[model samples]
Target: MSPKASTRVARGIITFLFIYLATPIVVTMIYSFSTSWVKTILPNGLTLKWYSELVASPEFMAVLLRSFSLGLLTTLIAMACFLPVVFYANVYNPQVKSHLRFITVLPFTIPGIILVTGLIQLYAELPIPKIIILVLAISLLSLPLTYQALDNAFIGRDFRAMFEQALVLGDSPFKAFVKVIIPNIRAGVLVAMLLTFTSAFGEYVLTNLLLGGNFETLKIYMYRLMRSNGQASSVLTTIYFIFLAFISLILILIMQHYSAPHKSTKEGAKK
Candidate 1:
């Protein structure tokens, strides 16, 4: 085939893939606006009644708040607990890097249901809420994603040199971490937080099994609506998608802003 013909074929494939991926989200957005979509190829009309009702729902409000709060807490807790550990593994002990990577990835090897079952069995006698248990489980599951992001940042450079330079300049360990390291790894840290928060936010299997009806998250709320009211569920999904998109955009902008100085200077030096 001619080069132009091959290019046309590639463009067609790309267009097809984009539409294939976006079709579900587009369909859901349309359905969310439908006034009455039953037995129709196209919605008869469009209205915001479903969304308005959803917004006014106290149960949904509670679920939304809980999901956001839980996701944020998961991010915060993972960063606090994992950053130092990952830094140590990557920068301090080369021998532990392989072992640490294996440990972080263990969560992905186990089926979520099995994992949840194990947690329930182990914590059956604990006096804590199932929600806390679910949070811990989700955080564990997100470990690989969070750790990999930070580890990639650490691997591309010599953090020990930066640390020693700070010490030589009379900065304390904490001051060195704050002044030199944190800013350098800001993008990686933000990426980790975004990944972990989104992962925990959307996790349903573990949430369903561990908490059941005792603690309701947005996922649980959506599942309930899905059983009773499909249209309401569609609206809820649209709202959830919008919320995720908005937060992702905000996080990406912050990451880019922090990354700008280092990215530009590094690229310039490379050239």
Candidate 2:
């Protein structure tokens, strides 16, 4: 194909895909604002009552708080468990990364239902809090994303030399890593944390099964609303979609902010 024709074809395909994926989200957003949408091609009337009711409820606030806590704790635990391991695997023993690949497919292979069943069998009678087990399990599930992001941060950079130089300059190993290595990988860490947090926030199966609905997070609440009130459920779903879009916007901004410096340097070198 000619260059112009190929460009037009690519743009056409992209536009079609964008609309295809966005249609359901658009309909849901509209439904959330509609007074009624039954057996009709379009909504009966538009109103904000659903959103107002959802936002005004104390239960909604509690659900948000619980989900936020889950997301934050899961992110922290995932980072604590994986950061050092990924750094060591990447900077010192590259061979270990081969074994670590198993983690990437862990969720697929084991599945949440099986994992939860095992947890129930193992820790059902234990004195340990199920909340602790829930947090740890969610963290473990998020590890593959955290590991890959941290490992990629080590690429094209001599982190070992940086660490050694910092150590030689009278910094302790932990201090050296915090000061020298972390700043360089801050963007990747942020990306990993965001991904981990999002995964843990929307988690349904494990949270519902493990906590037995005593700890109702956002997803569980949404499910409850879905069975009783469709309008409220739509509103919650829209809010969740907005939250994910906000996260994606942050990721894009972080990528652009980091890439701009490299682009400028490349142009300067060429000049």
Candidate 3:
């Protein structure tokens, strides 16, 4: 094929893929407000009744809150655990970075179904809280992406210059990290936070398997009830998507803001 034709074909394929990916989202959103609930064609009209019913359901409401709390906790813990490792890998030891990266990505390469099954058997033998176990399981899935994002953001950065800049201005290493490196990669941090939280929040398989019917995240709740109440399930899914999308948008906005030239201001203070 001619280069021009190939380019056109590629664009067409890209468009097709986007639409294909988006089809389910659009349909679900439509069904969230769908009234007729049943038909060969589209719903007769949209309504808010499904959402009202969803909000009134106590079990799902609690699940939604639990999911949020779990996601937030996971994001915080993952950042605490991974951030320093990323800095050390990038600044002090680039040679071992490859191994660290592999460790993060390994979980993803393993089939989740198999992993969850293994976790289920393992958790059954432990004395930990099921919710905590489930949260950790989901966080493992998100850790690699978070590590990569922060690592990528700092790839071309000069840590020595950053440290010097902070020190001259009266900053300790801890202060420098908090004030300099963290601020510089605020975008990446925000991206990582949102991505990690979303991954943990929406995770269903691990939560279901590890929690073992003892608890439910929002996704688990949605899955359990979707069969008996399609419209209500659709509404819950829509609300979840909306909330996730909003968080994602805020992350995108943070990235845009930090993309400009910004200096590190957190140095040389009271340790």
Best-fitting candidate, measured by TM-score?
A: 2
Instruction: For model 1, state the Cα shift of residue 175 in Å.
Output: 2.6
Number of the top candidate by lDDT? 2
Off by over 4 Å in 3: 1-15, 113-126, 164-170, 261-271
lDDT of 1 by residue, 139-255 (tens): 899999998888977856789899889999999998999888887788788889989999888778888888778778899889899999878999999888997898789777876
Ranking of all candidate structures by their TM-score, best first: 2, 1, 3
TM-score of 3: 0.84
Whole-model lDDT values for every prediction: 0.87, 0.91, 0.81
Minimum summed lDDT over a 10-residue window in model 3 is located at 262-271
TM-score for each predicted model, relative to the true structure: 0.90, 0.91, 0.84
User: What is the per-residue lDDT of model 2 for residues 1-271, given as tens digits with 9 covering 90 to 100?
Assistant: 9999999999999999999999989999999999999999999999999999999999999999999999999999999989999899888998989989886668667888899999889998999999999999999888788888878888888898999999999999999999889988988999999999999999999999899679999999999999999999999999999999999999899888777757547756988
Query: Candidate 3 residues 41-107, lDDT tens each?
Result: 8779889988888789888779988888989999998888888888888887889898998899888
Judge candidate 2 against the unseen true structure and give its global Cα lDDT, from 0 to 1.
Answer: 0.91
Instruction: Please identify which of the two predictions, 1 or 3, would achieve the higher lDDT against the true structure.
Output: 1
Off by over 4 Å in 1: 247-271
